[model samples]
Target: MQSTYNFWLVAISFAVATLASYTALDLTGRIFLLASARLRHAWRLGGAVALGVGIWSMHFIAMLAFSLPIPLGYDFATTACSLGLAIGASYLALVMTTRARLTALRLLSGGILMGFGIAGMHYTGMAAMDMTPGIHYQPGWFAISLAIAIGASSAALWMARALSNDDARNVFQKRSGAALVMGIAISGMHYAGMAAADFPLGAVCGAANGVNTIWLAAMVSLFTLAILIVTLMLSRFDARTTFLVGAVSKLNGQIIRLATLDSLTGLPNRATLTERVERAIQSSRRERSLFAILFMDLDGFKTINDSLGHSVGDDVLAAFSQRLLQCVRSSDTVARLGGDEFVVLAEHLASREDAGVLAESVLERMRHGIWSDSQPLQVMPSIGIALYPQDGDTVDTLLKHADAAMYEAKRAGRSTYRFFERSMNEAATRTLLIQSALHEALSAGSFTLHFQPKFHGGTDSLVGAEALIRLIDSKLGTLPPLEFIPIAERSGQIVQIGYWVVRETCRQIRRWIAEGLPAMKVAVNLSPRQLLQPNLVAEMLAIVQAEGVPCQQIMFEITETVAMQDAPKTIEMIREFQANGFEIAIDDFGTGYSSLAYLQRFRVKQLKIDRFFTNGLDEHGAEGSAIVSAIIALAHSLEMDVVAEGVETESQLDILKSMQCDEMQGFLLGKPLSANDFGDLLKHRTVAA
Candidate 1:
């Protein structure tokens, strides 16, 4: 006798199978994205229970739908065993589908394994009937049922992965269509297995005391449907929770960045620096080891800002921050304290020399510099290192000492690093005093120009004078250019001091002419910051014209370093100044690395030999006399006059005269004089020849 399926009960079984399949798809896809193994394992186990019950309930519901022609009830022990097989099959499906490195071989192999597991579950459920003659399966229908199981299992695996990848659109439609196909596959295989069943006409149910069939179908269907629904709802909640957690983490990271990083350079800010230094201090104290805090300030960064707008300066800063990050170790932390000042915490250092090594590396890299639109801008860093335990124990003290050392580095001419010294704090205090006095001196009109006259080396007649600014402060008392100029430059007062020098020189030239002194050219030195001023030439010309002084009567003196700093820019500005009939001279020549090609390009009126070379002239076959002779010859070849400055003795003057130096400016001829005294001397021609 053959068993038949009830169409209505069959529809219920198919519906249950469809829902279970859709839940399996949802469960596997969501579990794949979970980062926690424990959570995923919990979900996998829960999914297997829900999905396995659904599959088992659909099988039993369909079995209940079949008209057996004999009163039948399932064996209690076999029926329970069938449920175990179903749950095991569901677990196998979940595990196989969620592989990280899913490939064709794994997918094919997984499908076969899952297919066999499902068939085992179905066959075991058939055994739960336990008829008198036992339900025999026809070979042909059995083969067809197994084939359907395998093909459907493969199709389900492929569809689950594909739908997950293509989930951006038509989400409901895609899952629904897939669920329909899965329902048909499961129902067809079950019905095919049912068709294979050949129950004898005289068969009797063996398990008479087993569960009754009357309410079992309704109970299993409702129970399995509830489990699937609850599982799907929880899976949806978990997915939303995961998304919310990820979003919150991302927002928190951005907030942290805003609080701790410099907005302009993206380096750590001062707060972060303090925190890192504190951490390092704690760690070092525990380990009884050393670390270093490096405080760095960019040399001449103000001049760069004053010369080429702040925007370019910002670009340079950003680029160099990246370079500094690259140059340092991963254990080190770099921070921007604001406006050209930065700090680095070099942790786990073995010796103070290691800090020096890092500073040298930074200095070497900065020598090459970052290029902005073809202009190689130097980003020199004056770094000061303060060691842990040796320098100080607290963050504030270490930072202060490092800052004092950095000020000392700048005083020692920048482009270098210095370890913290106790004496530098006093020097730093003095620097602050001088800076304060500069402000008062500027307001009180205590700045005055002293004339240092230059004479013809051959005729000993005064040719011109260099106007040097002197500061007369009651508190600081008489300070020369060397005593305050560098400090003034660092404090950004050089530009104002520079303008004052130009205006005073023009006024003194007018006074001298009024006293009947010839309108000889008087040179005024221009600071690097002054030359970078956009309207420097125009402003100085206005001062001279207002004084009713001829442009030829004024000359501008720039250091060899300033002239060679940015060759093309300096040459262009020199030409602009010369166009207004003002002569340009390279002051302190041979003190800087000057390119001969660039020197020719400069085309200035004169070169003022630095006093360093002039001082060594008295020694026989001295390097100074040889260099001086070569310089004078080179100057004449280019039609440029060579002025030997800082002449103090007849021997030095005679050496310059022997080298045919065109002019001399030193104490040997005349000390720097007051404007009126210089005017009187020029008017009376009082110097002895």
Candidate 2:
């Protein structure tokens, strides 16, 4: 008897087979695109299970649609074996495709194994049917079916690989189209295999009875649908998870940028600069190339900031940073070290001369001035360059040496550049030594005060004295103020040192008063750093009060440059001091760039003519006389007493007396003496009186 097929059941079976094929191809394609090596294997295995079981299920379901004239049933063992073969083949195929690049050999090998496995499954399922007379196949039709299976399997593998490749565009659309083609190919192969089998007519066959064909078909369809639904849900979930991961990665990158970049200039910060320098060092070692570091400080930035306000200062800094960027190559890094200080790392430099050229270019760019709020503000750069290998090896050493050279440039004059030299290193070493020694000196009481007396220019009578610090270390004996004062200021030890000076001056003055000596105002010089101390006025007053000295008997002297550093704050501080009965004097008056208007604004008691004008008064002729005369006249107009500093000769004193200068102090009249020597001098003067 010939086999009779249920047309509707066959259609439903093919529809189910097509759906399963589409679902499997889509899953396999996604698995191929996975970036993680570990996750790819797990996803591929899951895909193999779906594809293998679905293919086997489709064949079995289609088999149930066909019926012989007699009863038909399946052996449970044989059916299970066919399903196992299909899954094993799928696993092998997926492994082949994903293990390496999809070359022709790999694709062909994988396709052959999968095709043979599917063919074996179809024939094995056919053998499960219990019939007295066994079924046979036509050789020609069987060969055609086998060919169809191999061809369709190879094409499916190729299509899936193409979709996974990065070069492919419109991946989703292409993958969808590929799925439809795969479904058709798989369904066609199944039908061809079914047609290849022949069931003879009038054959006496033993009927193996168990489940109905329609019920079996329904169960397989339901199972295939469940598997497909699960696969679809998983694919969607995977896509959502990937999108969330990508979004988080982008957010993290933004946060890192914010941390490493300057908010105003948008340049790298100190932390980022340090990291880049380390990286550059590594690269230079590998490439055997040289690099340079440039440390730049904007000269007079404090003046501009105080005069024009911080908002304008910010605008100027932003504009200057843009110009700085234009002066360097894109490969170089520019970073801000906070508060008008910037650093540049230039990589792959040819020689030290290249660094010089870069430094000059930076200076030239800064000369043009930055425009802010419709006003052009001019600021100059003091650039200090340190070369790789020549300057120092490590980042800290280079930065330290470069900063030392920058101060050298500032001392030479503003608006210049200086290359790091061996002398700078020596200076740096000395500075470090002084800083270490200073702390020890402060604790050990190695520092003492020396009194330099001022005399009335006309009468040559002792009037007052200036308190000077002397550090007498046992080993380093008698270090001058010039030797360690700058170091103290730079190391931020000036504030403590200043307080000591105030307390010691008060103590000496109180002792002199107790001895029945005439009370005279004693002046103490305050460093620029000390002037910036927030509690300066209160701290000094407390020290003087604690030592039982009258405020009027002590004078606080500051240089013009120091007074103008933060003009408004300086004015307020000076007012506070004056209000407390402390006298304020401008020391080294003629040397600093201060306007007469600002000088007049100060509620000061005295102005001391700087030493440079007084030293060569007899030799300098009219120019010297004119400057001294003008200063005395100006001081008289401002109702402030004028004190001539560094008056070393009788002739200089006569010139100051002629100019009506109030007082004079120098080595010629009285050398700086110990407190005991000053007391003896006072005693002798009292006896002379």
Off by over 4 Å in 2: 1-236, 247-291, 296-323, 335-342, 347-354, 371-381, 388-404, 410-415, 686-689
In model 1, pairs of residues that clash are: none
User: By TM-score, who's the top model here?
Assistant: 1
Measured with C-alpha atoms, the lDDT of residue 174 in candidate 2 is: 77
Per-prediction TM-score, please? 0.74, 0.60
Can you list the residue pairs that collide in candidate 2?
1-201, 1-202
Give all candidates' CA lDDT scores: 0.85, 0.81
Residue 436 error for model 2, in Å? 0.6
Candidate 1 lDDT, 1-689, residue by residue in tens: 76666787888999999999998888877888888899878888988999889888888899889766667777778888888877887887788777676688878887888778778888888888777887888999999999988888888887777665424588768888998899899888888888888887798877655456647888888999999999999988988888889889999998999899999999999999999889989999999999999999888888877777899899888877887887788878999999999999998888888999999988886677453445464668899989999999999999999999998888787899999999988887887888888988878988988998889888888888899889888877888999899988877789889888888888887877777768768898998778778798899889889878899988899999888878898999999999999999999998998678988999999999999889878754577688889888888998999999899998998888888899998888899998888887787774433
Worst 10 residues of 1 by lDDT: 369-378
Best by lDDT: 1
Task: Evaluate residue 39 in candidate 2 and report its C-alpha lDDT on the 0 to 100 scale.
Answer: 87
